[model samples]
Target chain A: EAGVTQFPSHSVIEKGQTVTLRCDPISGHDNLYWYRRVMGKEIKFLLHFVKESKQDESGMPNNRFLAERTGGTYSTLKVQPAELEDSGVYFCASSQMRTGELFFGEGSRLTVL
Target chain B: ELKVEQNPLFLSMQEGKNYTIYCNYSTTSDRLYWYRQDPGKSLESLFVLLSNGAVKQEGRLMASLDTKARLSTLHITAAVHDLSATYFCAVGSNSGGGADGLTFGKGTHLIIQP
Candidate 1:
């Protein structure tokens, strides 16, 4: 089975620009999640989607960051007016069940300068 | 608030040596996981340990969790160069699935040299 897949493996944008990262999870997987890892920092959770419904989004940094899952198939994370601090590797993951092993995608590296 | 801490952020060992990486969390959680990642690569799941006193082993790596101590340990036996990578331990907060997202510890970079 194919693991989680992400698009635009690398993105470089000027500060205040907008960039959207996309993720395609495995088929029939009900859980999709977003996480980020800043340089020199640990990976941190961003949000989660279960079959098109947001299960939890408490980890999102601010209003400038938005995530959407359409029809419970794929997910997109959009950073509006991206800031320098937004430069990081964004990872998308999916699991067959809750509390199960997560399959990760080749993360999208975002560079906001 | 939830926090995960890992010790010996860097490990340098000779092939055939044995060592353990430790993970400690600030809150109570029964679900813990270990993952491996090569440079510029996606994370690969290694182990999922749930419940107190749970233990799981695969190949040369063994993971054990002690809910009473709020600690999890990843033991590498007879390490080899192929075992070199960043190892991460994450603690799942709340009772539900990791859909809540995992609180990951700063990874432990392991280097095994011949």
Candidate 2:
């Protein structure tokens, strides 16, 4: 099976601009998750999706960040009015079972100037 | 809050040397996972420890978990240059059937100088 794939491996945007990152999980995988790592920081969880439902979103940093998983297939993360601090590497992962081993994507590097 | 910590955030050793990386997690967990990642690359799964005293070995790397102590160890035996990479340990809660997400440690960067 193909691993999780993310689009636009890198992105650059100006402060106050909006950017969207997309992730396509493995086929038939029910669990998808989003994580990010800022400069010199550890990777942190952002949200999780089970099928088409949002399982956990407590990790979301702020309202400017939005995530959606429609049709339970792929997911998207949109950052509006991006700030300089938002520059980081965003990773997407999926597992066949909930809490199981996760397969990660190459990650999308976002640079907000 | 669940917290996972890995000791010796940075390690540099000569090839053929033996070293161990430690992972400590707060609270109980369902399982512990070890992953390797080259710089600028995605994570690669190495081992999964499910129960107390569970140990798994692959190639020159071995991972063991002690649930009672909430500790895990990744021991590298006779390391080689190819073994250089960042190692991460993740802990998962007992949310039946994998409903929960993993909490990861800060990761240990290993360097094996040949």
Interface RMSD of each: 2.0, 2.4
Cand 2, B chain, TM? 0.94
- By DockQ, the best candidate is 1
Candidate 1 runs further than 4 Å off: B95-99
DockQ, all models? 0.70, 0.49
Residue pairs with backbone atoms closer than 3 Å in model 1 (clashes): none
Worst 10 residues of 2 chain A by lDDT: A95-104
- Tens-place lDDT per residue, model 2, B1-114, is 779999989999999999999999988898889999998889898988899999999999999999999999999999999999999998987744433668889999999999
> How far is A12's C-alpha from truth in model 1 (Å)?
0.4
- Compute each candidate's TM-score over C-alphas: 0.97, 0.96
Per-prediction fnat values?
A: 0.80, 0.38
